[model samples]
Each structure stands twice: as C-alpha cells, then as structure tokens.
Target chain A: MANMAEAVNVEALGAKQRRRFPHINWLALAMIMPSVIALLLIGLYPLLFAVSLSFQRFLLNRPQNNGMFVGFENYAAVLNDPLFWSSLGRTMTMLVIVLIVQIVAGIGIALLIDSSRWRVLNWTVKTALVIPIAMTPAVVGLLGVLIFNRDFGLMNYLLGLVGIEKINWLGDPTMAMVAIIITDIWQWTPFAALIMLSSLAIVPHEMVEAARLDTKSPWMIFRHVKLPYLMPGITAFMIIRTADVLKLFDMPFTLTRGGPGVSTELISLYVQRMGFRIFDMGVASAQAVLLLILCIVLARAYIHFFYRTPEAE
Target chain B: MAQAQNLQTNLLAQQARAIARRRSRIPASAWLQLVLLLLLLLFILTPFYWMVSTSLKEQNDTFAIPPKILFTPTLEHYNFVLFSPSAIVPTGLQNSLIVATFTTLLALLLGTPAAYILARFEFRGKRDLWFWFISNRFISPIVVALPFFLIARDLRMLNTPQALILIYLTFNIPLVVWLCLDQFRAIPRDLDEQAKVDGCNLFQSFWRINLPLAIPGVVVSAILCFIFSWNELLFALILNRSTGQTAPVQAANFMTGFGVKWGEMMATGTLIVLPVVLFAAIVSRHLARGLTMGAIK
Candidate 1:
C-alpha cells in the first residue's frame, strides 16, 4: 500500500512537471497586474476604509475632527438607531415579496412559453419581456412615476374607467412600497422567466414524457421532474435578485425620494442619506458594514443550500 | 404478436390523423396560449408604450386625463430634449457613450488576461482570487459611494469622466473576468496545448488562438459592460455631480426640480432605454447564459 501511494505521488509530481516556460509566472503576473491593482484600489481599499471609517469620527460637515478613532461608538449608534432597524426591515420585506412574486410569475411565464404551440408568438413575447429587463433602473423608476402618478397617471385613469376612485400610489407610505414592488416586479420577472425558460429548454423531454405517462396530472410531472431541473436556475435567480433588492436605491431615489417619511427607504438609500445627506459618515459606515454582513450571510446560506453541505457517512 | 402489431398500427394511424387535424386548424390549447401571450405582452409593453406615447404627446396632451391614445403625435418633447443648447440630454448622451465605451475597452484589456489565467492555470489561491473578483459584483455600489467620493476628492479627480471610468472598473473588471472565464472555459484546452507544441509561447497561444475564439464572449461581455455602465446611477450620481452627469442621472434629476416634466423625462427614458434594449436583443442568448453563470448552455 505504501509503495502504491509512493507511485501515485510520483505520477502526480511527474504530471506537475510541465515543459519549462521560463518567466511564465512573471508574464502571468504582468498580465493580471492591471485588474489586481484596480480591484485593490477600488474594491479592497474602499471596503477596508469603510470598515475603518465605521470605527472613527468622519462626518463630512464636521471635518475638523474627522478620522479620529472612536471604536465601537459608530456601531453602537447604528445599533441604537431605530431608523436603521426599520429600514433594514423594510429592505428585507421588499426583497422577500419581490422575489416571491418575480419567481412565481417567472416560472408561470416560463412554463407557459415552454408549452406554448405558437412559435412566432413565443419569440415575440420573449422579446417584449426583454424590454423591461433592458431598461435602465432609473428610467424604470421614472416610468413608474408616470404610470403611478396620482391624478393624471395611467393607473388612476384606468381605475377611473372602472368607476373606482383614484388611488395615491406614492403618497401613502404602504402604497409607496407597493408602487416600488410593482416597478421591480415588472423589471425583474422577465429576468427570472428568461433564466427559467433557458433551463427548461434543456430538460430532457423523455423524463417528462415518462412522468406524464405515469401520471396524467401536470402538477405531478412538474413536482417530480421540472422542479428539480429548475432548482438551480431558481437558486441563481434568487441570489441575483436578493443581492439586487438589498442594494436597491435608484428606484426609490427617483420615485419617492424615500418620501412621505422614509417609508420606502431601502438600506442603500438609508446608508446614502446617512453619509451624504446628514454627513454622519461613521454611523453610515457602521450601517454599511452591517448591510455587508447581512448580504454575505444571506449569500452564504443560499450557496450552502444550493451546493449542499458536506456530510459524514 | 399479431394483435400487438394491429394495436401499433392503429396507434400510428391515430397519431398521423392527430397531426393532420393540427395542420387543418389551430388547436384550442394553442389559442389559449396565444391569448395568454398577448395578455403578458400587454402587461409588459404598456409601461413602454406609455413612455414612448407620452414622449410624442404635446405637454397638455401628456397630462390629459383618460390619456390621449388617438391624439396627433408630435416631436416637440424630443426637439426640446435634443436641440436646445441648454439641454442636458445631448451632453448626457455623449458622456454616457464616452464613459461606457472606454470602460468596456479598459475592462476588456485588464480582464482578458486575468480570465485566461483563471481559466487555463491551476495556480495557488486561484479559487480565493476568483471569488474575490466575483464578490465585488455583490458589493453594493452605495456602500462604496462615500469612500469613493472621499478618495476622489482627495485625489482631485472629482466630477470628471475619468473618475467615473476608474470607479466603474472595480465592478466592470470583475464582471468581465467572470463572464470571460466562462467563455474561455467553453473553449477546448487541447487547442492551447497544440499551439504550445507548435513553438508558440503561452502568451502567443492566448493572443493568437484563444482571444480570437473568445470574440463572441468578449462581444457579449462588452455589451453587458456597456449596458451596466450606461445604466449605472449611484456611482455616477455621486462621482459625476455637475459637468459630467450621465443620461440616467439627468433623467432622475428631472423628477426633483419643480413640476414633474413627464414628457421630457419620458423622452430621456426612451432614449436611454432604446440603445440598451437593442444591445440586449442582439445578445439575448448570451445574456441569459451569462446570467445563469453559464449553467444553462
């Protein structure tokens, strides 16, 4: 057994011994230098500095005492602040609702498209869906403003046709959230659907046919065959959407300005307002760090769930 | 055996008859699906229709209750947005084009080499390094806004297109690297080995063989980068405050200043949305594949 192990090691070492390309490592280093430097300066440095700022006093307006180390104070302040917790809650709420809606709607659309007999219509419908996905978020927000505008908005105009009273979308706090969700759903459901359709396209039809033969019910086939095939795509969509919703700023910024009183203030908007508007850099940085932790934790959980945890036999 | 043969023949006949029936008239299910598709299209297209139709309406017609679907379309809004000397639209469009174009070019330059190494080599700390690159995409741009602002201020790079370009590289590089990594992986490794056996160095093989093969991927990544850079708001909002504002930033500002100018805003939205939607359609398959992290195809 020892001789066999030694032989395996020898073979591994032999395979590791590629033909000498002198200075290749240096060349590779040279090649990667530009990106490495850029990421370091922009990605790594900002992250580190943000963490440092979290432990210090760096208010923009009060620059006299900027960068003074005040460890844990900022964290304490952010923790103690009710607004931070509330906005974080709103952020999570938005993420969950939007994700659930987009995913379900997306799957429905995908299944519809996948099973549809009209090939030309399928192509046309897909192209239409791509429009929302391709629109700039800011523009999407502007479009939302136009659609949901209280008096002359298309929504109200349509509601009037049904003899219903005009509803204030951006005015009421709860309605503002709804408006944001509506815009987000319109923009992102297509993304989820597109992803789902592509994955569904490649699902082996034989299994589906066999399952159909075994059971006449569509739900049974979907549960047994399609859902498993869709799990990875769904998970991917979930990750992307979760990360995006957590950082949603552009929509609320344009639509409501976190308005009527911070009702639609996502964490990104919260952090931006704190740092830029109020000039509370330290606490904003703390909130930013917490936001980061939240994102990483959520992402890690999804990844673990998707990849499956290691098990001992 | 004779009975089974008769059943099989009957089954084949039935299928042929069913095919003939389908050819003769559209199936009920097909009609149902077509209706469903049309409903979804209406839901999807209404907002866009509102944008374009509103853009073409006169200002009074834009706000007219039970909005004008049959009114004479006008280009007054577009004329104001484009031709006015003080119009931010033309300048914003120009800036957006410049910044997005350069960012795509620079990102490709920096990212292609990194993607190649990550794809071909089994180096130390590779997984960690690659993760580090990808995780940048997940980091909220808002989180970096303040720090970026401070750094830019300190460096006297504030309110310049270059500042915006440099800031974009952080996210764009990671994006290009990951997307290009998928592209490079799709390519066979044997080609590299063959090129090497022919006295080509590693760099030469990559430059001559892999880079050319990966052009489709590069084009897809470049388009994505362009769309992202064009659509970017928070960074551009912060980094380019006044003189260097991009189209999206200008559009957002239109909401804040005074009475909402729906017509002009819609025009701007239409302008920004048009190029990107076109780009997306051109590479829709690649975009979807990349969004799936190349897990689809």
Candidate 2:
C-alpha cells in the first residue's frame, strides 16, 4: 500500500495529490472518499447501529431491524446472565495471566536478545519473532489445536516423556479456558517483545553504563533506569494488547469454538454466537456496547498516559 | 507491595554482584549472551517450524508417540486442499483472493487521499479526526459482526462474496487511512505545493507527486489489509454460510469435521501459510521503508 502511493507521488511534484478547491483538498478528498465511505457505512454504521440497537429489541430473523425501545433490557440481560459474568471473569483472568506472561517473558527475552551478542543470534531471534506476528490469528488457533490434542498431540507426547498424563487441552472445562489463554500468549508474546524491543532501543544507554559504573546490579540498573524508561512502552502495549485480547474471536473460534461447554467462551465469542447462531442482534449489540465502553476506557487511559507529555499538563 | 519490594531487592542484589564483578574488565559475556539470544529465537521459532513440519508429515508421522523429530514428507495434504474429491468442502482460495484484492484496492483508493489530506492540510478538528480514526481500530471485530450480519441477512445476501468484502472494508479502510496518514506525513508537502503553484490542482498534485512518493507505505498497508481480510474468519463465518467461505474458514470447517484428516489439514495449512510467507518475504523491504514514516521527514 505504501509503495503504490510513493510510486504515484514520484511521478510529479505532488500536485496530483491536491484538489482544485481553495480550502478543501477536494481532489485528495475525492480519491479518499470511496474508502472512507466504505469504512463509514460498513465500519462506522455497524458500530453506531450496535449502540442504537442495544436499546431496542432487535432480532435478525424478524423483518424489522428495530424492535421495541427496551431501555437497558439487553444490558440487564447481560448483567443478569451468570454466563456473561463468568466469561467476564474468564476474560479478566486470561488478561492477567497472559499479560503477566507476555510482559515478563517479553521483557526478559527482549533484554536477553538486546544484550551484547553476536549479530547472527540477535538477527535470528528478531527474524523468528516477526513470523508469528505475520501469521493470522485463526491459523495460530488451528496450529494450537493440532499440537495439543489429547489422544495424539505433540504437547501430550512431550508431557508423556516427563511422565505426565495426556492432557485434554480443548476438552475438560477446567483446562479449556487455560488452553485458549496459552494459545493467545503463544501468538502475541512476540508482539509484546517486538514493541518492547523497539522502545528498548531508545532507552538511554549512558544511564545504563553509569549505573554499571556505580556498582548498581544489572537488576538495579534495569529497575531504576530501564523500567522507568520502558514503563510507557509497556503501558502502551498493554492498552493495545488489552483491547485486542478483549476483542479476540478468531483464535477461540477456531481452536475450541468457546467450548468444553462455554468454559472458554470469551465475551466476544458469546456475542458472536448470540448474534450469528441465535440471531439475537439486540443481545449481541448490548454485548458490543459493553465491549466498546471497555475499549474506550482503556484507550482513553492509554492516551492520557502515553500520548500526553508531562509538559502539556 | 512487600513481595514486590522483596523481589526488587533480590533482583538488584544479584545484579549488583554481577555488575561489580564484570565492571573491572567490562569483557563481553559473548557465549552467554549468544546462547540466551539463541534460546529466545528458539522460543519464537520452534512453533512455526513445528507447524511447517506437521504440514509435511504423513498421518502416521504427525501423530508419532515420541513425536517424530524427522520424517519423510508427502504432498497428500496439499493435493487434498487444492483438489478435494469430495465437493462438500467449498473451494475458498479464489474467493479469498478476490475479496482480499478488492478490499486492498478499495482501501487504497479511499485511504491514500485521506492520508494526504491529513498530512498536507490543517483542517478544523483534524486531530479529532485522527483520534476518531485511530479509535475505530480499537473496536473489536466481533462488535461489528452482529449488526453487519443482521443487515446483510436482511438484504438476503448471506453467504455471498459481496458480504465478506463489505465486512472487510470496515476495518481495512480505517487501517489504510491511519497507516497512510503516517506515511503521507513523512513525505514532504513541498512537492505538492510546488505542483500546485505550477498549475496542478489538488488531485493532480496527489496523483502526480504525492501518491508516487507514498507507494511504499501504500503497498505495505495494502498487503496487510489483503492478508488480514484473506485470513479473516468471523465475518466470513457469519456472512458466508455457504458459497463464499474463505480458505481460513474452510480450513477451520475442516478442522471441526469428523475424522480429522491430518494429511488434508496439513495440506490446507501449507496452502494457507505459503502465500503469507511469500507476501512477507517479497515485500520485506517495503515494510522496512514504511517503518521510518515519521522519522525520515
């Protein structure tokens, strides 16, 4: 996408980019409108309509798009459902577990790789990290399913060598959610590492060296110098990752379909099932509203902390 | 808080000893660092290697109790995916490619100019617009799935390529705009101004000068958009009940079907992964170029 634009731009000075209008870049706007319109109609409308329909009793099978203006009934329904609360709990649990694992593991691996090393090792690690990021979420889920099947999975086979029982990875309500969480971490930890690596490059090397000179331990230097420096990046990644995980559908959908009887069903999975299977748009929209609100809260927090410089305050 | 403090102390103490011991010479821990880095690479890469290996392994090989470290591979899986004897499984590669291509083109057409506008112009509510654009990215795919499914069904176009294409545009378009915005900002606007002063209009400036300079960014976003849409499952699953199921969705359908055919699944998996790997490798340079969007300015 980037190359095509540059290719077009290099043809002339860039006058072809502008519109004929004095105030408006109408021509530029003109070229951009089709996509924006599509985005608005498809992306914007569904989102807006979700909020709109959340207040109504909408059903997919029904001819009517709108239903009775039931104020907060759907919200009440979600709030009332034990399943919703459990899914929320599961999501929160998964969030904490995966976040801790990724953040710690990501920082650890990043630190290890970022240390003085042969260019070959550093390059190989960096290269390996990029491949998973490039893979589709659904593909990752399928791979997990293949690798973790109890009767004949690689994970079980590995466990067998250690004298462990073949675990029912996608089965057994007790462990199914954990399986989803692990799969997510497998796919995303690299993303966390990559972002941290990018920010780690910008960390003040002199400070680290000075700390080293002060007889500060590597751990101490990292705590006082690196952690503070990486804090913002960590928070930024958390915000991004949190929003992403909260919205996760493809992996869970592919791996377990929110199964072992909904134990692994995330809020997104619940909403998707409700919308698609039951055709309950009202309930789905309600779930969506809840999701949007959570997302917005995190996003606001992210901007407040990361995008806003202290000087502004 | 106490545990955290204790952890901090323990970590610091360990670090202090190591640093104090190393500072005298400041000799590099070449072997240790190299080993640690290699371990990290292994952590990142082993699973992917495993995925490719599974794709190559025979049924007996994939399920080998000890997990075959090595095996003779076959193209049975690829044969099944590319040419299934049973017509029950829908052919999705063409639909996926078509939808992905259309979505990319559509996103580029709309996204490039918006990026230009944001990059070149100082409009009222510009920052707000940018925030709005970025904020949309945070919305989960499922949130949009419900209403989209509802509307598409109401239109009676369920299971059609048009529906999948429509749903993809929702996210792809915004991503394009945001990505292109960054790229366009890096491009110097002086050229556009020059072209304008030279009697070239806004569109003329963009098409003739700005677009060409921003191709690297455009291609990067376009490829991402296409790949994502191709791999997309939710909308494809919901909107496509029958004919227009994509490769990923079809692959998933195969996963859940009874009597898991490891060979066929492997073949499908291989088919799915090959294009993405090629796409990444082929356009890796553009990715690097696009990464420096703001800095190069």
DockQ of each candidate relative to the true complex: 0.45, 0.34
Which residue runs does candidate 2 get wrong by more than 4 Å? A1-35, A61-66, A306-313, B1-28, B87-90, B281-297
Q: Per-residue CA lDDT of candidate 2, range A205-303, in tens?
A: 887888899865788888888887677667776777788779888888878888888888888888887886887788888988898889888766755
Which numbered prediction scores highest in lDDT against the true structure? 1
What TM-score would every model get versus the actual structure? 0.91, 0.86
TM-score of 2: 0.86
Who wins the DockQ comparison?
1
CAPRI quality of model 2: acceptable
Writing each residue's lDDT as its tens digit, candidate 2 over B27-77 gives 557767766776777766777778788878888888777788778877766
Write the residue-wise lDDT of candidate 1 on A164-279 in tens digits: 89899999999999999888998889999998998798789999988887999999998889999888888888887788888898877888889879898888999999998999
How accurate locally, in lDDT, is each candidate?
Answer: 0.85, 0.75
